[model samples]
Target: MKIEACAILAALLFHSLSVSAQQGETAAAAGFSKDIAPILTKKCVACHGPEKSKGRFRLDTFEFLMKGGESKSASVVPGQPAQSELFRRLTARDEDDRMPQKDDPLPAAQISLIEQWINAGAKFDGPDPKAPLVTLIPRAPHPEPPSSYHHPVPILALAFNPDGTELAAGGYHEITIWNPNEGTLLRRIKNVAQRTHSLDYSPDGALLAAAGGSPGQWGEVAVFNPTNGARVRVLGSMPDTALTVSFSPDGSRLAVGGADNSLRVYDVPAGKEQLVIQQHADWVMSIAWSGDGTRLASASRDRTARVYDAKTGDLETSYTGHQGPVFAVAFSGDGQRVYSAGRDKKIHVWDAKEGKEAGQIGGFDDDIFKLLVSGNWILSCSADKKIRQHSADKRELLRTLAGHNDWVYSLAVDGKSKRLASGSYDGEVRVWNLEDGQSLAAFIAAPGYPAAGETVRASTRE
Candidate 1:
């Protein structure tokens, strides 16, 4: 979401957990309200609870068990006692001592009782998961009219502010800010200009810069106060509608990409054009700054992506392999890699400094629009209507999320939890808990918020 025409993203808190064994019915419930708490407390809690926390294992509650031991696998499934890992470890064939280490396993009758409880679906009632985690209900930035989906708006871009407090998005010349948790719009920074095209927040979160223009024509960029939405200064104008904008890591300068096949850099405080590079042979599709602010990567419609030295405005190198226009580009945290996705239906990983093609990513049937890198994972959205997670190094597809019904246009990452938010051409923004592909929020905007009953979700692949 963009605040005051500059891109500022709201920090989102994600909720989810990845489970195994295909999510069987009641594996975790192997011991129920009447059966399990006491068993664990009597046999396990002493060594595992807060005081000792032996093996970094704590089993005072179901959530603790769900967040099993250091091995990181499900210990007690809610259903399916047969596959419950705890059962296997306890009933080990070698009985030198299976459970309790020195003592024998729980008596046979007690074990049977536990099995029965698990089969019933581990219905937990001990306490709410957030009792210890004070959940802060975010103040609503966008008002809820009995329903937020009643009226929907076309969305184009989204970004989180440097400090992670605000979100900004543009498309209808309108920017909406959300608390990121309460799902409330903190403020709506309105822009009356023709479709707003680009947004970026200064490194300090005090200044915001937005760039856009009449479609097909050169555009303009503006700077504003992030907290008040007051206009600060005009960054300058573009030769064509801009595609993306970025603030240098130090927040000293702003870069803009345009349809005229060029990238321009602007000095922020002075509000003057610092350099213009006629690099891409076609419309520049995307641009990203390395973490250190020394380099910038650009993806373009010419089926190529290139690196530039930010200081000299000189061409560094061009990496090409896309069979189609490159739509998106991003630099890794350490600035070692550049990830680009495009119309060719593939993602190409390139070494930023050397501009060498590092690896090729495939598994989609359509163009890729946006790409973001986090640690060893690359999160991407595609024309395939899917947001996927992949191993940045191994070139392995990790998960393919199937919720969007239209082309995904933008993507954001939860810097802390590694979750994702995807906005699509379909007028819906879906938040996914990338850890398990959990669909936490379904934000749908239409001309008028539709009745709840009118909402429809695509059938998940069985």
Candidate 2:
């Protein structure tokens, strides 16, 4: 009986060892799309990806990653980590020789995972090895917003629907819609990026487009149904935040600008990419479509504003008078002139065809954040906590709407209601009677957060 028990125990032990070995093999087979791609995209791809390829090495795709660079050595050897130049640089001892030269070395766990993956034969698991790394990694669901806020979040973006019935304000990972007249919380649309920098409604008000993203990781243009708050579609997954989005006069086309230094245009109905203009050397901060939809004007951190043929993506002209980063841009009602403002603290109006400075609007105390051309009036918001109206043709200051305690980052106007809305960095959204410049309504945009002396119970009841 003792011999039989010993034999049985030995068989069970063998089975356990077999299962352990299988589990180890599975663990060593790190998925390229899931495990390895995220690490490279977050840490290494900024310097070696599509936007800027250092040493002519591009890790934007699996195919380009293995193609190597000027090193002449192979970037990857199917089953040999030591023989791979990419792995060698990652593990190099010399600081200058190490990959991601300026950043700290990759953590040990991540390095070990790469080593094990290579040893396990570095198989391509994604559907397309030629596709960009951003497409390969599955996006995790975004976290939910807090039920109530401890403090106010800066309102960087705001918009009023075409009818001016509801207002939308950017929040942390969400957009909050409110009654412009009553300052009542209507609803919140969730599942957005970390920050929303700009918002606009289509000409017909069928769709609302939001531009923003995580600062250094990725940017996108999120479209939604303003009525029901259902996401319509998403566009542009660039390397950095998409700072601005504008709809064409016909509402058939949408233009997007990004920190990726590229301007992308999309067909609203077909959802197809129309053109990609990359003339700017830095972040493209804002976009404005011409009245006739034939041209587009863009503001950039490159200290220049450029005009482009809307359909062909041809460069019409570039206005460089700002001498600093341009934050806002708009085309005149006639489509013959462009108005741009930024760190220069003045609105520069120029001839669109020749890029010549026509006139300037002075008296701004700080950098301007937005420029809106409504009828004959040009509305602008600035870091000086004021929104000023100027004549589009004469370039004369008309009225100053001042009340925001912090920088006014965005502005929206309603022609029918004769009301204007402005969002500030202090988390305040204010509505004004456009005719008299009188304050109509004001409230903190954060959901479930009490206003001034109001209690949390009172806020939640709404």
Candidate 3:
């Protein structure tokens, strides 16, 4: 009887071992590229992929996955699926502890495949063996200004010097400085960027900062001498396109917003990054520094605006009332209030000190692209091809300056001169007298480049 029992026990043990072996083989057959990469691209890449990295975690490549993130440990534990943070987060019961926050949890089958891959030693089979493991560097040369015969190029960004003597309009690889009073081009600051998205003058009017990049490739922020257009300092480059740049009240630092969904502050004199604030879930569209320069406000395509401590990079508050992508943000003269506008066709005002909604202005027929706060007025330009002026303290529509035949892309206000500059997609730049709501000067910025259609007559209303 004892011999028979021993044989049965041995047989049972052999059967168990065979099943375990089969399971291991199945796990080993799960390919990293074929099975695992797709799941990550679809489910994880939105937050951890290129353009943005939440929690400092990036899972776009096998190397990045192994390097881990802020936790500073391998997210995947080879041969130990149960112990892996990657698998654990996917299966976490608590929503807060889950891998993809605010998104639907991965289906069970997808989770199983990831677990199997990790259990099988997490080997990688890259798409190309010779491909570089890092993100591709931008190789495209900076664009040059179009020849005189070429069509008028759209102006996307505009700014005024503190003294209101000059206006800076962003062009392809150049910043065109104009005499706002004479309605003539002064000089072209050349070879700055391939596409300029934002421009700002230092508070003291000594420097002009240009922000832009080769979309989907790289981004740059360059400071230049406004007097001679000499390149002063190239702050640095980013992995994605930068859309907005603003100088601090004292001009000692700069705040930059970019497609990477981050707000970075750089020290001007030291030429080094001082702080990186990552909170927005989508592209950061605009950034504004307070009058005191202690607080910074940023708007994002994530449908929210946020205020951050400029010095510490800490998030002070977030304004979430905008229903669409927030594209423009500005702080009032005293830095006590914040204003933001976006695709939702509404302007939201917030108390900077309390982080509470103060007021809202809505009536635009299209997306508002840029905003300027001049004294008690809030001026905005829109895709509707018009520039609208509003009372800052009240929800009153002051006037609408309509002249652009295409989308209005940028706006700049010179309070000292009482002039408002508006740039449009058709390459027209119109300067308006705020006091009388009259078109003071009008000209085609890039003369021959009329964007999508033939050049229209400039509005020269007195």
Candidate 4:
């Protein structure tokens, strides 16, 4: 009976030691809610969270965590830390392979904690797996009606067709095509972008690319058949509003600048992102592709302009003399020079190859919003209520077209017709005789209030 008791005691002792050893091995086991979640929120969420899923991998919930990303493989392997991609990324020594590509790698202690959790079976006590995925996009509010009929809706962008037969003016949620010679509205392209900020006709005049978005909500680039206004493709649903879009000279690619402080180039045929350039520090307000389609110039609210390789997404040159946000940018016809203007009240010309400031036109009374290169002329419109033309080669002011009562937001030139179009904050659209700087016609783009006290339902379209 004593011998039997000793055998049982030995068995019990062995069991206790086994449990103790297991506890020692996982002494730093991480809890999903306590340790691992916070680390992910702080270190991983920006690119992998609701606003963006870089590789389609989201760390916000357990289901997405388990579903993994484009690879369709598991990110975390329960009970096998060595085999886990998450563990491998956290502990990766190579910068290019490391998680959080833009930031420093996770600390060793934090990595160890994650590894311990994976080895401990990677349990999650957060939201139920069966719960619906959290909505990443917020509900957009109903847009307010236009204030008055007498005052037109503000036009933010303008483009003249390559054939010089039609002009496109960007209005609230629509683009209006007008006969330039007759000053009559042609067709309205409706139900497109919320507020169109930029428009470009493809080189062959076959397509029109419009760029803009609801501020703080979403950004999109919509390509349309110019003849029928049929959408050819919608390229993006970016995190923030896109301010400008330009088609490459070859018409094979499009470059977009956005509030997200990045420049994205999209393949025209594939409708997929070809490259993402992340050198800008703030909102990228404008972008222009080189005449040869080899380089791209971008202006930003970060008070700088950058020129980079269009295909490689490599920074070629940075123009940083502006004291305020750079709102406009354009490449010269020859692609040898770049032009930019902004709140600094200056228009700067840069040497495309050397990246040096070639010339500048200064002394504007207010912010300059748009710049256009027509022939040898550099036409710019300003918040000071004036559209000024300057000689691109000589750096001399050629003419000042003064008719806008409010800030002029956009400018387009028709070299064939010798006509220039300007859009303004007061919802006024004015066409000018470029030769004499005379206003050929003036009309309101947006409908205004009927009279002082009479209630008039705003005409959503003309």
The true-structure Cα RMSD of candidate 2 reads 4.3
Candidate 3 Cα outliers beyond 4 Å, as residue runs: 1-48, 51-143, 447-454, 457-462
Q: Candidate 3 overall Cα lDDT vs. reference?
A: 0.83
**lDDT per model, in order?**
0.70, 0.87, 0.83, 0.79
- The positional error of residue 325 in candidate 4, measured at the CA in angstroms, is 0.9
lDDT of 3 by residue, 68-174 (tens): 78985559888998877788888999999998889989988888888888877888776542222222232344566765536566788999999999999988788
Candidate RMSDs in Å, in order, are 27.3, 4.3, 12.8, 13.0
Candidate 3, residue 349: the lDDT equals 92
Stretches of candidate 2 exceeding 4 Å from the true structure: 1-29, 50-56, 92-109, 116-131, 452-462
Candidate 2 CA-lDDT value: 0.87
How many backbone clashes are present in model 4?
A: 8
Displacement of the residue 13 alpha carbon in candidate 4, Å: 52
Per-residue lDDT of candidate 1, residues 177-205 (tens digit): 65444344666565424555566777778
- By summed lDDT, which 10 consecutive residues of candidate 4 come out lowest? 130-139
lDDT of 3 at 154: 74
Cα lDDT of model 4 by residue, 49-135, tens digit: 555888888865667777778865579889998888788777888998889787988888888788778878888755455321221
Clashing pairs in 2: none
In angstroms, what RMSD does candidate 3 have relative to the true structure?
12.8
